[model samples]
Target: MDNDISKLKIERQPLLATPRKSRHLGRWIGIGIAVLVVTGIGFSMANRPTSVQLTSVTQAYPSQAITVLNATGYVVAQRKASIASKATGRLEWLGVREGSTVKAGELIARLENADLKANVAQAAANIDVARARLQEARAELQDASRAHDRALDLKQQNFISNAELDQVKARLDRAKATVAGAQSGIGAAAAGTEAAKVAVANTEIRAPFDGVILTKNANVGDVVAPFSSSAEAKAAVVTMADLSTLEVEADVAESSIGKVKVGMPCEIQLDALPDVRLKGVVASQVPSVDRSKATVMFKIRFVEKSDRVLPEMSAKVAFLERELTSHERTPKMAVNPAALAGDGKEATLWQIVDGKLKRVPVQRGEKLGDLQTISGPVKIGDKVISKPTDHLKEGGAAVVAEK
Candidate 1:
């Protein structure tokens, strides 16, 4: 009975082992099938035909007149200056400081002028003394004249000797010489007084023109000089600029200089004020050219006054080909360059009409940069291919993609 029971247990073990091996084999087969199905789907998707979608933009006829040459420059005052002293002296008073609007002949600064003032006073006293001497000499001349007349009368009457008359005449001549000398001395002294007054005036600096004081180089107690190289000599007491007489100094390329002329209309755009466009004109073309830069400098003057404008503000100048006619001044629609096929003589563009690429003929005008002016039956809002592919033909079906 024990042997039979053992045999049955061995049989049960074989049955359990067979079932477990079969279950493991089934799991591997299921995994292999899943991988094969996934690979097949991936291959199928990749092989499928894909519809090519081309990127495109529309084109329209351009209308506005465009300027040819554009150059950058800086706004500068034509009559700007750095005012300095003509004579060396310690600055005693500064009448004007930075940002001070001054008129022509306005007093700007003054130097220590006590010495000059004293010299003028001394010169005036000398002139008075010389005048007194002149008066004394004139009185002597009158006396001499009376004596000479008496001498002549004596000679005529034969009451006095000829030698005595001659002696009286010599004395009268001597007095005349003294009077002339005194008169000359008075004239010299008067000239000295006038010169001293000029020196005193030089100590007081005045504005050369109507302007705004942009800088003040000297303060009270600073030593100012006539732009010399002494350690203590300050060159300029004040630096001013005429804001009303502002101009733009532009360096135009030598090649473009011929297109520019005096009085040509220009549109100025300041870098500081990008939104503000100022009207101006070509004031003058500098006669000399900068050889190193291969450019010609031009002067442009603004037509309108602007308080925002300042000296040395960077600017861009657009020199128009011709003054924009009243009709051309308004903004107009424009088209892309690729829309025009061929060499711009006769051009064609593809437009989608009824889900088809319809070829349209256009007459082309002058090219404005990368854009070209076109006249066609199409209107401004009409859609046209920017750059049509060679596969695109007349009456071909087009799948319009979202732009």
Candidate 2:
């Protein structure tokens, strides 16, 4: 029985030893997998790109000489005027409002001048009364002259005293003086009547020029006074501006004022109209400079009429240093800015030669738009890596892929 117990203990020991050896084999397998994963990660990190992938474009670009002048200003009207009443009265009617186009001598508004009308009637009546008085004085003077003639004849025949003839002559002269005074009074009345008529006519306001009304200061039923010191009196009935005489007023720095002169070509861009570029010429350069702003104001007139342009519109002016040549306006060959590296001094690019990266040196020219002009030892059909990795050295094997 003791020998049988020893044999069972030995069998249990072998079974326990077999489980320990299997555990050790499983640990070695886990360690090998972990090492392979680390090696793969290190290789991927070493082959990663140094910079981000960028798109490269090869196309034509401009290489012309361009001078950029930064300037800002506003559009203004050259011919602007304010419409106001010429006589004091209540505004009865307004024929035009703001933004209304009017021609010269066109009625803009009318005033109710009751007092002026009455004065005109009174002057007309006085003129008639003065005419009647002059007629009566003339008749009396004729009658006196006739009587003096009879008296003179009687004196010549010795039938009357010398005193009687002298009295008749004196009466004739006095009647003639009374008629002269009545005639002078008639002339004065006629002048007063004409003046009253003129005052009544002045009550009606008219446009002095053909232009668009910008502002309407006085409305219907508002009292308008001519040449008043009060705030309301100083106000204009309507403000009008000529759209045809629109001009751009640009504030150019004092340093650049010397380059600008009258008759120089200018390109104007309105904030309201973005797609359109209007041509203009420097009309005049103001002699004086604005000391506070340290700038000189220049006036530019549009060469062509534009219906879209208005007074006081915001605009940007570009004063071209030189006109573009025919070839410069045309397109030229260019490549992506990212394709060429360095401060444009030494351009470096990666070219694919037989499925391997080949570093190539290139010469670059002026940048045009988003692409730059490149010229050197590179062909058009050759593929270039837009974003190259540090591991992608010359003669290095590479696999081409599309982004």
Candidate 3:
């Protein structure tokens, strides 16, 4: 019976069975695991927000759009003077030093005036002596005139000799001449006194205009002189500048000169005071051009001068095509230039709305410094992404980078 069961195809019921379907099932399970891993990775990637940096749309002006060029120059005072004494003498006193403000005709320094004062005293004494001599001459002339009249009367009455009358007349003439000589001496002495007073007045160095002292070139006991070349002589007692006359001398390139005009609006920046922006206008343009630097000089007068503005300080200026109003100085709408995505009259900026990046279109205008003028749905306070990723699309969430 065992031999017959073995012969029957069963041979014996095996403890384990090897099926072809098992190999295929194992392969199918591996494929399913791989698919789950790929799906999970994709889901994580799709949910991640794009990292971005953001800037604001700001208020700009009309002239900011018309700015044609920018150039660097220096702050210069159109009315600056070196205060010095016209008369050469040792400096006796200095009233103003560096940073001292003075008014027009204010005394800034004084020179040694001992000799001038002595000369004035001498002239006064001489005039007194001359005046005393004139009084004596007048008395003598009066006496002489009386004697001449008496002699003339006696001669007429034939009680005196003719020779006596002639002698008295001659005495009267000599007395008159003496009186005239004394009067002339007094006039000459008075003129000497006047000249001495003027000399003393010249010893004082005065401010020609209202200004601030920039330097104190001379000190007490220093010899001050005009056109002084001697090492011991100080030519300028103090250097002063009119703060009100402060202007910027900008060097505009020849190629860009055509865009600048007289009275064109400008923005001025000083290296020393970088945070404060100054408003100015193109006051004048130099007739000549600098060949060595290929630049034309443009003089810009500040609309409002600050006390911090100094002479010969480094500066930068932006020359616009037209003048701007006081309200225009403050921008109406502006944006960073980096936010612009395309090149044309219209600029494209990606804006974040409800945490999603959205493409915004704005009409581009002239630039003010680094800020660009724009007009669109975006207003002054709206924030826009500065730089966005290429893969970032409309309605995609963007995360502001902490960095």
> TM-score for model 2?
0.69
Candidate 2 structure quality by residue, lDDT tens digits, 15-50: 545678898999999999999999999988766533
Order of candidate numbers by lDDT, starting with the best: 3, 1, 2
Per-residue C-alpha lDDT of model 3 across residues 1-403, encoded as one tens digit per residue: 3567645674567588768899899999999999999999999899788889888877655554666788899988899998778899999999987999999999999999998999999999999999999999999999999999889889999998978888999999999999999999999999999999999989999999999999999899999998886778999999999888888999999998888889888888788986567888999999998999999999999987787788999998877666666666665578888888888897788987888889988888877667888888877778888875577789987788887
Model 1 lDDT tens row, 1-403: 3566655554434454467888899999999999999999998865543222332333421122467688999999988888887888999999887889999999999999998999999999998888898889889889988998998998899999989988888888888898888889889998999999999888889999999999888789988889656888799888899998999999999988888899998878899986567778999989998999999999999986699999989999988866655554433344687665666467777787777668888877666566676777766667777666676667766765556
What pairs collide in candidate 1? none
Model 2 misplaced regions, further than 4 Å: 1-21, 24-68, 231-234, 321-403
Model 2: lDDT equals 0.79
Which regions of candidate 3 fall more than 4 Å away from where they truly are?
1-63, 325-328, 331-403
Q: Of models 2 and 3, which has the larger lDDT? A: 3
lDDT of 2 at 118: 98
